[model samples]
Target chain A: MTDLLRVVDPGLYTTVQDLGRPHAISSGVPPGGAMDRFAHSAANLLVGNDIGAATLECTLIGPRLVAEAPCLVAVTGADCELLINARPAPMWSGIFLSTGDELHFGARRSGARMHIAVSGGVAADRWLGSLSTNVIAGRGGMHGRPLMSGDVIAAVAERSGPGVSGRELDPHLRPDYSNHTLGVIAGPHMKRLDADGRAALLGSTFHVSRDADRMGYRLDGATLRAAGDELLSFGLVAGALQVPGGGQPILLMADHQTAGGYPVVAVVVSASMAIAAQLVPGDEVRFEETTIEAALRVRRERRAALDSLRS
Target chain B: MPPPRSTTRVRIHPLGDTALLAELGTRLDTALNTRAIALAAALKKRRDVRQAVAGYATVTVHFDPDQTTHEALGSAIKRLATKRPPMEEPGRLHRIPVVYDGPDLESVAGALGLQPQAVAEIHTRPIYRVFLVGFVPGWAYLGPLPEELAMPRRDVPRTLVPAGSVAIAGRQTGIYPLATPGGWHLIGRTSVKLFLPDSDPPSLFRAGDRVKFFGVRP
Candidate 1:
C-alpha cells in the first residue's frame, strides 16, 4: 500500500508535526512544531507509529482526508465530529479506511488542538528529524506550510497487525484551554518590578489577543511595571512571560523565536503548557505564583501518567 | 584564567508540573551565563528532561512529570547553580554577508548625522555577539551596535520584511531569516541562508556565538 493521503481541504492551521526542532536555537532556528506536543505523541502511539513519527496536527478545524489505500487512523485531543464517506466516525477509536474513503473534520466547537494519527504514520520527509511545519521560515511539513485544499499527504502503508485501539486522555488531565489559570514562576527580571508591578501580575486578569500564534501570545491586561531600570537584551525561553515597555505580557510558545530582551516576569511550567496551547483569542487567563520546586514535582507526576497510558 | 568568582543572582520559579524557571540576574556577564548553560546542558542530559527554555538571562528546565517533581528538580537545579563549574566551550560563531542597503538606511544615517556608508562602516566595525534568538526562527539578535548607530524601531512595522533582510534597532543588528512582518530599520539584505530545516545543523547560527556582517548584493 502506498503511504499517501490526498488533501481535499486543509483545515485552518493544519501542519505536520512531531516533537520539534531541538538544540538548534543558537543557529537561530526556533523549536517549531506542534503546540500540543504531548497530544501529538499520544495520537502517534495510539496509531502504532514510532513515538516521534510525523503526524498531522489540526487546530480548531480539521481537514478532509481521502484515503488512497487501506489504512488505520485515529484522532485525539479536542473532540471533533468526524465522518467518513458521510458516515459518522467514532473519535479515539482506531478504524480502518479503504481506498476511496474520505474523512471529514468539521469546525471545532471545543478544544484548541486535535491530532490525527494514521497507521504506519504519515509518509513525509523529515527535516532535522521532524515533519513539523515552521511557517516563519517556510520549511518542513507538506511544503513547509499549512495543508491547503488540493494537497496530498502520503502515509507509511501499514504492513502488519491491526493498529492499537484508541484511548482517551485522562479526564483529570483534560485541559481547560478556554479558561486557563496558568501558574507562573518568577522570571529573571521579576525582581526588577516594584511592588505594584508584582501585584499587577498576580492580581489582574489578562486576555489572550487575536495576535496569538505559534510565535508568541500578545496579551492585553494591566501594565506590569519593570522592577528596576532597563534590561539589556538576554536569552528567552518558551514559557518566559516577558512584559515589554507596553506592560503587556507576551507568553512565548512553540515556534517562538530563540531570544528576546523584554523584562520577563514569569515562566509557565510544562504541566500547564497543554492548557496553554488551548487558549484562543479572547480567552481569559490569570497567573498564579508558585515555587519552582512545586512546579517540577507536578511535571514529574504528569510524565509518569503519560507513560502509564501505553501500559 | 577564570575571572574572580563574582556574585550572580538567580531567581527560581515554577512554570508547571514539567518545568522550573531559573532567572539569572541582570549582571549575567560571562561567568553567570556559563553556569546557566552548564545547568541547562546537564538537565538536557537526563532521560526525563524534555526541553530547556532559556531566555536572555533565565533558563527554564522542562521535564517529564512522572520521573521528577518541580520541587525535586528545583532543588537539584539550585544546588547546581551554587558555584558550579563553568561551561567548557561556547557555541559556534558565524560571519554573514549582507547588502547594507535597507529601506531605513538613510533615515538611520541622518539620525546619526552621517552618510549611509559611514553608518554601515560604523555598524560593521565590531563583530557583534549573538545575545539571543527570538521573535522568529533563525533571527539572531546581535547586539550593542555602535552607540552612534542606535535608532528606534519603525513606528509602524512593515507588512513584510523579505527573508535575509538585515535591520538594526538601538544597539542591536540582525537579519530576517525569512519573509515576515518586522519593525527594525532595514539597512540591507543577505543571500546567505540563515535557516534550513533539511540541513544537519538547520540554523546558520545559534546563541552564544559571535557574528560579523559583510556587505553583499542581490
Candidate 2:
C-alpha cells in the first residue's frame, strides 16, 4: 500500500465507496455505495482499475487534495471542472499526477455527485466484505465516515511500472443527467393507493425536495391518497418509491433503511437508478410506467455498454 | 391445545427487476413470521439468490437479473414455500431487564387507563418473538404486544432517541440499537447493548428469536 493523496479541503460529504455491501442488507445494514454506479465504474475503468475497486464519491462540491506520490487518477460524473496545480484538466480521462501536485475541483456544471478513482484503487477499512462506507452505522471506509481535512487516502497497490494516461471514455456512452423522467415498475403495494392516487403518481411531475441525500429523496407533488390501513414492515431496497401518511413520495436511495412500513407505490427500475442518483434538490422529475420485461432489457443494454468499455 | 397448522398461501410479487417479495401473510402472527423466516433461509441457499431478507411477514429475495428471471425465481420460491421444511427448533431466548422510568411511561399508562406499575407488569407478561431485524443496524422488531398495551406511535417523533431505549408502537416493541430519530412510545430503558458493530453478527437478536423483559430498580 502507498499513500496517494492527502485531503486539503474535504468538500461536501465525500466518502470512499465501492459496489457496496449487498450481502449485509439482511442484517439491517443499508447497501451504501456510490450513488451513481455508472460514473463510479466509468471512473474506475478510466484509471484501469476493477469496476468494483474503491473510489472517492464526492457529493455536490469536490475536494481539494495534494498528491503524496506519483499516481494515475480519473474523475467522472457531475461535470465538475478538474484542476491540476491551478491548471484546468479534462474530466472522464486518466491524468498522471506527480508528487506534491495539487488537485482541485472548480464549479460543478451538472449532476450532484462525482466519482474519482486512482489507478490502484482507494484503500479503506472493509466491513462485511466491502470497502464502502455506511455513515449511519459508522462502519467501513475511513473510520466509517466522510473524508475530513488532513486525512491521507492510500492506494491498495502502487503502479508496477510507468502508467498510461489519457484514457478517455466516449462522450456518447455517458449518462445524461439532464433527463428528468425516470422509468418505474409497479410495486407490490400499488393497489393500496386509491384510483386518483395511482393516476397522480404517473401523471404529475414532482420536485425533489431539500430533504435529499443518500438515504432517500422526498418528492413534493400531489397528495397521494391511499387506504389508511397500516402496512406491515417489509424488506426495502434502493429505488423503492414509498408513500407515507403525508402523501409525498420518497424514493429510497443507496443508503436507505433496509425495511420500512410505508406503502411503496412503485419502484424505480434498475436502468433508471443512475438517473435518479444524479438528481439534486429542486430538480423536477417525473415517472413513466414501464414493464418488468422492458426494465430487464434496458438493464442488459446498460451492462453490455459497460462491458464494451471493459474490453 | 396444540397450535393450529398455518395454511397461509404465499403470494409473490416483483419488487423491481432485480428482486421479488414473497408475502406469506399480512398479519403479524407468529406462524406467519416463522414461515417467512423459513422461506428466507431456504432462498439464501440458492445459487441465484444474492440475499434473502425476512421481514414481518415477507421474504425479499434479491438476485442478478442476468443470472435468473423473476418468473424463474418466483416459481422456485412457490415450490419451496409449499414444502414445509422439518420444523426447526425455536431460536435462542434472551431475558432482558429494563428500568420502567421513561418520560412517556406515565402518559402511556394514562392512555391505557391503568397504573404505571400495571403497565410494566403487562409489558413483562409475554415472551415476544422477533419478527424482523431491520429499520436500523442491530434493531430487532419483537411483536404481538398485548392488545391492552397496543398504542399508536407518538404524534411527534423524538429528534434523537437514546440507544437501548425500550419502546412500543402498534402491536410491537423494540429496543433502539443506536441513537436515531424514533416515533415509538418510550416506556423504559435497558442497560444491555443491542448493537455490537465489531461482532460477527453485530446484532443481539435475529428473526425468530424470543425476548422476555423484566422490570429492574432504577
Candidate 3:
C-alpha cells in the first residue's frame, strides 16, 4: 500500500468510484461508477488529476478523513460545508493537506452526492478494470463495501506533475441542482406505451421517491401503462426510464442492472444524467425530450466545457 | 468481404449520448443472443466504445461521447452487425456440488408427481448453458431446465433468499451467489463462491459457459 487514510466517520454512504467498468456489463456486472460524473470530473480536475482517477462518492453526507501523507484534495458536486482542523476550507477548489490533517464535511446544501478527489486518486481494489464500488455484488472499491468507521483506504500518491493547490473551478462549471429538468431520448420501447401513456411519461412531473438509489430512482408521480404482456429480459443502459406494471416510472441510474424486462418509455440523455443523479428524495423532476442528434451535441459541448476548465 | 447483412437485420437505437442499444431481434431466440454477443465482442474492441452489455436479444453499447458520436457509434455497430460473425468458442464446463434438501423440493416433487430423488437426479444431470447473467452478480441464468423441472416463478416472491441458494423458474435454473429478494423456487444449495469483486474476473460464469451439478452428501 502506498499510503492509507483512516476513516473517522464514513458518513451516510461513501464509496470509491471512477469512470466505471462499462464493458463488464457483458459479464452481468452493473456499471457501478460515479453517479455524478460531471462533479467527479470537476473534482479530479481541481486536483490536477485525470478523469480516470478514482474519487470517493459521498452520498448525501460526506466522510471525515485523517491524512496520513501530504497530498492535494478537492470536493465537488453537492455544496457541502468543508472544514479542516476545525477551520473552514473551500470546496470545488484544490487544497493541499499536510500529514495528520483532519477533513470533515457537513450539511448538504445542494445535490445528493459529493465527489472528493484526492491527488493520485484512490488505488482501492479494482474489479473488472474499475475502482467503483458495487454494493449489490459485494465487490470493488474499499473491501467491496461501504466505508465503515475505522476502515483504512489506500491512495497511490505518486504523480507525474507537481501537485497544484489553492485553485477553484469557474462557478459556471460547478453543478447547480436548481435545474430540475432532465433531457431524454425518445425511446427504444416507447411503442410499448399508447399515446396518452406516452403523454403521461413526458407531460407529468415526478417527485423523487425515497426508493431512489444508485440502482434506480423510483418516481412518485405519472403513470404510464405499458401495453402487452411481460417483455423478455433485454439489455438496459443507464438513464433508461422504465415503467413497470405498477405504471410508476423508475429511472435507471449508474449502478443499474445490466438487463431488465420492464418497458422503457424514454432514456435520459447522457448530457443530463448528472443533473438527474444530483436529485435528492422529495425533489421534483420534469423531462424534456430531445433527439439523439441534439443529445450528442449537448454532450460534446459539456465535455468541451470540462476540458476547457483544465487548461 | 461482402457488406455485413443478415436476413433479419439488427436495429440500432440510441440509449443516450453515451450508449447505443442494438436490437438483434424481438423474440427470445438463441441465435439472436449469439449475434448480440458477437456484436458486443466486436464493439468492445473499438477505442470509442466503452462497454457492451449482452442481453437475451439486445446488446447495449456504452461509448465515450467525448471520443465518438452517436451517429458514428451507430454506424460502427451497423457495420459490425451486417458482417457474418465468427462461430462461438466452446465454453468451459463447471461442476457444482449441491445438497438436494430444499424447502420446495417436496412441493416441487408433488407438483410434478415425482419422487424427490427423481427430481434431484434430473436437476443434477444436464449440462445447462449459462445464459446472460443478470438480476445479481455471479447469479447465472441456466436454461431450458429439461421442461419437466421447469416451473413458473412464485406468485409471491421471498423478501430475502440466502446466498448460494439453488433455484429455478420457468424454462430457467440458477443459484443465488448472494442473498437478495427473489421469486424463483428454491430447490437446493451450493457451496461455491460465484463472485469475488476484488478478483480479476469477478464473475465465475460468462454468457456461454456450461454448468452441471452433482449431488453431495450433507
lDDT agreement with native, every candidate: 0.72, 0.89, 0.82
lDDT of 1 by residue, B1-218 (tens): 99644334556665444456676655535455556656676777878777774555567576676687666777777676675566457567677777888888899888778999998787778877665655565676677688888887888889998988888987778888888888899998888887665676666665567888876566
Total backbone collisions, model 1: 53
* Per-residue lDDT over B45-151 for candidate 2, one digit per residue giving the tens place of the 0 to 100 score: 88899999998889988998877898899888888888875586788999999999887899999999999999899999999998899889989999889999999
Q: What are the TM-scores, per candidate, against the unseen true structure?
A: 0.83, 0.97, 0.91
**Error in Å for residue B35 of model 1:** 6.8
lDDT of 2 at A167: 75
lDDT of 3 at A198: 77
Candidates in order, interface RMSD in Å:
3.7, 1.0, 1.8
Off by over 4 Å in 2: A160-162, B1-8
Q: Please tell me what DockQ candidate 3 reaches.
A: 0.58
Q: After TM-score superposition, what is the CA distance of residue A188 in candidate 3 from its true location, in Å?
A: 1.6
TM-score of 2: 0.97
DockQ of each: 0.41, 0.78, 0.58
True contacts kept of 1: 0.51
The candidate maximizing DockQ is 2
lDDT of candidate 1 over A119-172, digit per residue (tens): 787766566666777775567777778888887777665633345554555656
